[model samples]
Target: MVSKNQIKRITGLHQKKFRNEQQLFIAEGIKVIQELYNSSFEIQEFYSTDSSLQLNNKVKPDIISETDLKKISCLKTPNTCLAVFKIAPSKPIKYEGLTLVLDDIRDPGNLGTIIRLCDWFGIEQLICSEETADLYNPKVIQATMGSIARVNVVYTSLERFLKNTKQPIYGAFMDGDVVYETELPTTAVLVMGNEANGVTATVEALIQKKISIPRFGKLQKTESLNVATATAILLSEFRKNLSGK
Candidate 1:
């Protein structure tokens, strides 16, 4: 049974301010918790309603009731387990290969999906403007599935980073060069912008190449693609080229 004090603290993690203060974040669902346990993130607290659900041969989770789990879970439908893990220190951004830059992507689900997309394409480092959604946001975490454990995400000033980078910078735009036609490099900085406004003028000014996914429908009336969908398409094209296809 989880005590009332413990419940309060766990529930507090749902907020960004509290998560920052505690230096810990929560991961619900067996897969997410298992992935984090297998990665560098250290497990701080583990709770589950089933005693048979083992993380591994070494660690044992504290068995709690289903009622207690709902109190701490962030989801509408609680998973079988929840684990609190220490926020791993952000590593220095390495501009070696295919660095993805997010320019104020405010949606947690979009950010989370993008992170998973990064992991899928083997893009190890992700740079986000300070205005981008928090990587540890519960919604983002849930959307990431287990990919959060594999990608390195960093938040910093977009303008400064763009100004200083030596690699070719590419920004996605509605009127830019079609991405399918452009010759993409294996190592470059690709900037994905906000969901509604697209890239900011300041960042757009710094881009060496502007790229876009063309519209194919007869009407061509679609306003835009979702940021995460655009990212998947772009990343696929980039990787497809990298393979010499």
Candidate 2:
């Protein structure tokens, strides 16, 4: 049985301060919780209708009332499971392959989708601006599907990380050299910016080179692509070049 106080604490994680104070965050949906349970991340608690708990012996999941599950869950509709996981500390960044650095991407869906894209492209490391949405925000976690386990998302100062990187840096820009034409570097920092605003002056100043995606659609109305979609295209090109595609 999930107590009222316990529900209060779990729901409080919706706010950043609470999440930090407790060192835990909520993960909804059966699949998302299942993935976390299987990862190195420690699962503090989980709730499911079934009392058997046969999936993982380590997980001593508690049974909770449907109403209690709904109260603590972030989703509009309560999923089959909700898990409380200890927030993982930032890991040592091993920047060997094509890395993506995001500049203040505010949207949770965009960040989550980007994480999924990273998983698909086999890009292991992602560096985000300090102001970017929290990777463990329930929305971002859910949107990632199951890729959260694979991608190492580090939230730090984009400028500092870019400045220190030994590899070349490529910033995505609207008014820049065509991505397809540019001689793509094997290993580098690919900077993608916010949905509404592009890279800020501070981050922009650190960029050593700029590249852009050419739009082929009939409508001249589409001036720029969404940051996440643009990210997919750019990474696609870089990966293809790496594979001799």
Candidate 3:
């Protein structure tokens, strides 16, 4: 059984302030918890229904009752299991492969979807501006499914990182040249903008190359693509460019 103090601590993770103060985050679903359980991130605690406990026995895990799992869960209908994990430590980037950077992406769902997209395309390290939604948010965690274990997301001063990085920078903009026509470098930072504001001028000025995914079909009034969908399209282009069969 989880204690009242533990529930308070777990529930507090729903708030950004508490998550930061404790350097912890909550993840639900047996799959996500199991994936992170096997990752380098510290497993702070675990809770599950009686049936769920049989899924694994690798760790000498702390067992909590179904009632306690519901109490600590942030979901309307909580999953059969959940976990509290120490937030992965942020570190200076050592660039090697294709890098993805986000400039103030605010929506948790979009961010989570983008993370899963990164995992799919094999772009593992993601850098984000400080204003982006917390990668540890429950909605983001749930949206990522189990892909969170495959990506290392680092949030910092995006502008500084862009300016100081040694590789060619690729970013999307409304007025840019077509992504298909341009020659993309293997080492590139595919920087994406926020949902509403788009990439700021400061970062735009640093963009070594600009590319756009042109609109094809009718309904030309399509304002813009959703950030996650755009990211999938862009990353797919990059991966195809790198390894087209």
Top candidate on lDDT is 1
Q: How well does model 2 score by local distance difference test?
A: 0.86
What is the C-alpha local distance difference test score of candidate 1?
A: 0.92
C-alpha positional error of residue 240 in candidate 3 after TM-score superposition, expressed in Å: 1.2
TM-score of 3: 0.93
Considering TM-score, where higher is better, how would the candidates rank from best to worst?
1, 2, 3
Model 1 segments beyond 4 Å from truth? none
Per-residue alpha-carbon lDDT of candidate 3 for residues 67-101, written as tens digits (9 for 90 to 100):
78888898988878888899988656866789999
By lDDT, the better pick of 1 and 2 is 1
lDDT of each residue in 1-245, candidate 2, tens digit only: 88889989999998888988889988887778778778768888888766665346666568987788889988898887788899988788876788999999999999999999999999999999999998878899889987988889998888778878888889999888998899887688899988888999999999988999887888867978988999999999888866745
The lDDT ranking, best first, is 1, 2, 3
Task: Between candidates 1 and 3, name the one with more favorable TM-score.
Answer: 1
Q: Per-residue error at 125 for model 1, in Å?
A: 0.7
Per-residue lDDT over 9-37 for candidate 1, one digit per residue giving the tens place of the 0 to 100 score: 99999999999999999999888888888
Worst 10 residues of 3 by lDDT: 52-61
